[model samples]
Target: MADGSSGDSAPYLRVAARLRSRIADGIWTPGGRLPSRGELGAEFGVGENVVRRAQELLISTGLLEGRAGSGTYVRAPFERRPLLRTPSAAGLPYSGLAPFGFTGTWEADSTAKAEAPPLIAARLGVKAGDPCVRTSYEFLSARQPVMLTTSWEPMAVTGGSVVVLPEGGPLAGHGVVARMAHLGITVARVVESPRPVHVDRDQAHLLGIATGSQATLIERTHYDTGGRPVETADILIPADRWDITYDIALPGT
Candidate 1:
């Protein structure tokens, strides 16, 4: 047994690398349970804490999954589906937001009169501390949580209107474009900026992934024909689960 202290790299990282190699080499098949921390510590000549950290690193990388009351195991490979994004159109149904072929249900809650944070307010073209309707959603497929989203709409845009509450009134469950159109605001385009991010504790718990797991954060906003922002949202998708694809129409096509 070799002590993990021989190299300059962190002890846990070295152990994690070796374990990753072992898994890649087929020493541990997919869904195969790994030996206990004590056993791995003994074999690696390291402390149990080091082994635990190594396992955690692998878990965050989606290479392993830990089951409560059960040992950690190699994660089984999964198909990565593509989430399609296209230009915004008037009257697009809320169901159209689902990934292709994703026959699942989503739950959403809207909080009216919520104050918009600085970042969100900027995205919505509103001043900080402005009242906004905040809606959070959890999209599930096959009963497994797949996506999380939090959207904000400036109250100034929808205040006192029937569509003020995104998930309420007759426009309930209608998408942003349609909801805005109901208010006589013509939605012209949708813009999205996608960036890689690490899932936070709350997000990880909701997505059923380890904290610090890789994910994508998409900042999406709907703009009216006059170029005024109507709504802005943060869309979170697990990196290991889906790929985002944009559908851009060519000019004059």
Candidate 2:
């Protein structure tokens, strides 16, 4: 976007664009430390504030990563790995999208029996304080934490059922569709909404990234054919190591 016109873009944006170009140009190889902000400012003829903003933007976009007590460096990019979510033609999608940072296999920890908060209750159409089985899943890819997912299932539907503990039951690795099927609930549909999110201090520690590192949040819900909501979950993905791709098949194609 740098058209070489100073008036066409904001000072920080121009700096960011130039740095992006430099990164793409391989001026600083992957994993190489970038020049310090003061040095970059002098080289680019910009002030420290402008340089800082530029660096922050790049850091957020995964082009750069900052180290504690160390300088910023180019972030290495991995292969475009797939977090597979294959859907069935008639039934709901059986695949659960794994964290983007995963290169091969992953694992998660699940807990239960917590009151559903207002937002979650609203999503599941339950009372604000309704009893639900809550499970927090931290997924690791390539032996590193890449995503966090917290799910809630109302006791009204899953209570007294054998599949109560999502990961412990026989259908543990089968995902939401099969789990619901075990309770005579057929997941006819699934929905997901994704949005941008920046990592927090604790999240950064878990994902081994900076606090302000970029990520995406996906709010997903499963539904039965009768239009009843069965389960709801939130999936967090690191932007630096993950990419999302959607696949849809047209009818009769």
Candidate 3:
């Protein structure tokens, strides 16, 4: 890679661009093993570390995959699925957890009597260290992990009830609206704020992606008819694999 013409671009990024071009030109087909880092380093006239970084950059972009003890290879082509957000037929706001037409299954673990942190407390309109039930979820499509969510519910609301533990008791897995409804509470609204973020190392490992990969974080909260926040959750979606879309119902429809 020539550094003379390009201004201020990192060497690894330049190498990554050249590698990307080669992949686009079919120099390396999908699932085709790439040359060793040392060989690529020699070919690119850069250090092996630089080549490694370049390969990592490509991997983070979903253009390449690295196998343990094996070499890196071009990733197979995959279509981006749309994650639909729409209101339910009953006129309630959508949870935005499961996408429209998604046939996936989810696994969740709920911990009872957990103390809410400051941010979570603020989101739930409760004081820090308030007792809450925390549930962590991993949603999979076709047996592959596609989303992650962590939800917190105030114990003051569900305490002494069958829905105290989200994943336990009679209302297990029924969702916040239904569980609250069982307690004679009406869920009137759901508020979601989505933001783009880079996946951290732990999240990357769970999602089978590279650290620093682009993803979306949705801060979702459920409110009762009286405007009290009942539950709040943070949902993580891989940006490279899915596009988020909203379907709004017109008035009087």
Candidate 4:
């Protein structure tokens, strides 16, 4: 232990850092059972949620694994793979927006349909009958679909001068967001909401899984600089092997 813990750091993070240090120092050897969440909370005089957040970080980082109701233990030291361009990689050029790092083949339809559904309509903030272009993409990582996203953009935004680009195609190699910016429409904020859902018949087929499987449903809404909606996307990810990292920070000064 060093000097007294700093108040500037969240109690949970401080606790997590201390435990991480212990593990790195070999104090808590690999394949060892670590303290229970409740025990760790009590040790740090913090709530279980705080301890849990810390544990989640370690788990996401491949340092720990939770064994259901049993307890969390140190993960075996697997071969450390080199850092690759994961979807969560910071400042990634296109943010993994394109599937498999390949120029994606576009789809003008939504799951074999020509029009957007009511649920998608609500997400795009458009009228039920409004024309929309749905772009379906599958991104593979390690030879598997690590990310699948379907986006609906208002046809109005695609018409007129922008009409040159067609459906079932990537946006002219300029990137969709960049193209929108060129049209004097700047995306100001991106709001992402993620929830776990049972994979339906269609999802199972596209994702190569059985029905009723668990998947993470991630919905993202892109807003313009004026706070107007520009596009909405729904991404389905198999829960067992996929992970999404969300970083929150204060806006740049």
Candidate 5:
């Protein structure tokens, strides 16, 4: 927020607006740490308390997070796992949520890699060589590979934590949401879109299915409070072992 830039509102509110714009415009991003109050005050020529107030306002609005001893940072958006257990929801939400009725792990192995594909590149808003988490998960279905998923996270936000991928690991216990939360990054929503696609020879080989067999492609993107894209995943599921179910009430039924 600029000093004496405008009038008629509380100083903190104006600061909040400016911070919001920076985040919306991608100046700040999920898992990105914000400047210290002293730094902000120096930049805007405002008092330290004024900057602190502004930060408090944004935190209350869910755009920023205040971490003890770590300074403030932009919070990760929420990733809505409707299928995962919520205290009040009845029945499991989706087939993918549980693999053979057992809780499993989502591991991050492999080194962080840069994205070169045009579509992924565009979604991540990064250049070809930008660093990202090269993560893969093998979901167990009665102790077999029910689904294979790969995810990519911006390295700037992950802070080198995305490289740990052993089974029964820290991430395995809490899933990605809890891991992000420990890092002060929250997932505000998760949007999943799944569609049927013909399995190619390569996919069939990994999934133990025949070429041209039917499969479902699941794509999910998670966003943060400030609406920055944090993580994205693509999963391939074999049709034979999985069932897609949803409930709807008919007027005359």
Candidate 6:
């Protein structure tokens, strides 16, 4: 019992709170070694099991990291990144923006005449065997990878056009909306569905994180005025390093 308890919460939760507070207030430095389980139990006047539970709580939140054959240590904190979402108007210019506020660069690779995946095909209103142009983007913040994105555009809509290859000649690096505009398409609005998912092996390799690390998955579709899908993309952001923000505006406001 650190101080007093509400007498309702699990003893371990209270212990976790106390330990979390100490870590926040700089009682321990990042990478600093933690006291042994027995020592922690003694300090908090709780059982070793209780102390272990508290340590587990911190580990889940990334406040503490355990090393194999070594010991648990304070984990370094990461800055939260914001992904801005605001209402977009028709015929507006497109900006190639990364989700974070970090100073860095993005690399995009073009893959042309690829068979549309089932998911991408459904989003683009095309068959699974339809031809499409795929572009993969890796965004790095301060030379550290942060986000991974894959965009697909149906060749049925862009085949043989100047903007057929998204990362191709002249209009390279321009976002989907702008490239679509090259074909006289007027984008009305974009729809995005976001959820939390574990990073797969491919994503982990790109983001430099452990496999199964938590990440945010965003599915976005670019639609023209006639409600036609022009492009679809999957955006992945590391959960530990970024905070997702959606600036929603209510109708008739």
**Which lDDT tens digits does candidate 6 get at residues 1-253?**
3344456789899888887877877888887888988998998789998987777677667787554345667876657767665544222243244653446798888888999988889999999979999989888765556788898888889999888987786777667767877789888878888999997756665665556778889898988999999888998888887777765668898
Q: Give me the candidate number with maximum TM-score.
A: 3
| Candidate 5 residue runs with Cα over 4 Å from true position | 1-100, 103-108, 161-169, 246-253
Model 1 misplaced regions, further than 4 Å:
1-58, 61-76, 88-96
Q: What is the Cα root-mean-square deviation between model 2 and the actual structure? A: 7.3
Residues 157-212 of candidate 2: C-alpha lDDT, one tens digit per residue: 98888888777767775677788888888888888888999888777656657677
Which rank order by lDDT, best down to worst?
Answer: 3, 1, 6, 2, 4, 5
lDDT for residue 217 in candidate 2, whole number 0-100: 85
Model 4 off-target regions past 4 Å? Answer: 1-114, 163-174, 251-253
**TM-scores across all candidates?**
0.72, 0.66, 0.73, 0.54, 0.53, 0.66
Lowest lDDT 10-mer window, candidate 6? 88-97
Q: Which candidate has the top score in lDDT?
A: 3
List the global CA lDDT of all models.
0.82, 0.75, 0.84, 0.63, 0.61, 0.76
- Candidate 1 lDDT at 168 equals 88
- Candidate 5 structure quality by residue, lDDT tens digits, 141-251: 323344677776677777556423312346653445555666787777666788999877566444434457677787777777777777677777766556644344457
Model 4 TM-score is 0.54
- Candidate 3 lDDT (Cα, 0 to 1): 0.84
Pairs of residues clashing in candidate 2: none
Q: Compared with the true structure, what per-residue lDDT tens digits does model 1 show for residues 24-110?
A: 789899978899999999988899999988988888878987654467889887678887775532334432456665668988888
RMSD of each: 5.2, 7.3, 5.3, 14.1, 22.1, 8.5
lDDT of 4 by residue, 133-224 (tens): 66677654423344477777777666555432433234554545666776778777677788999877566545434457677787877778
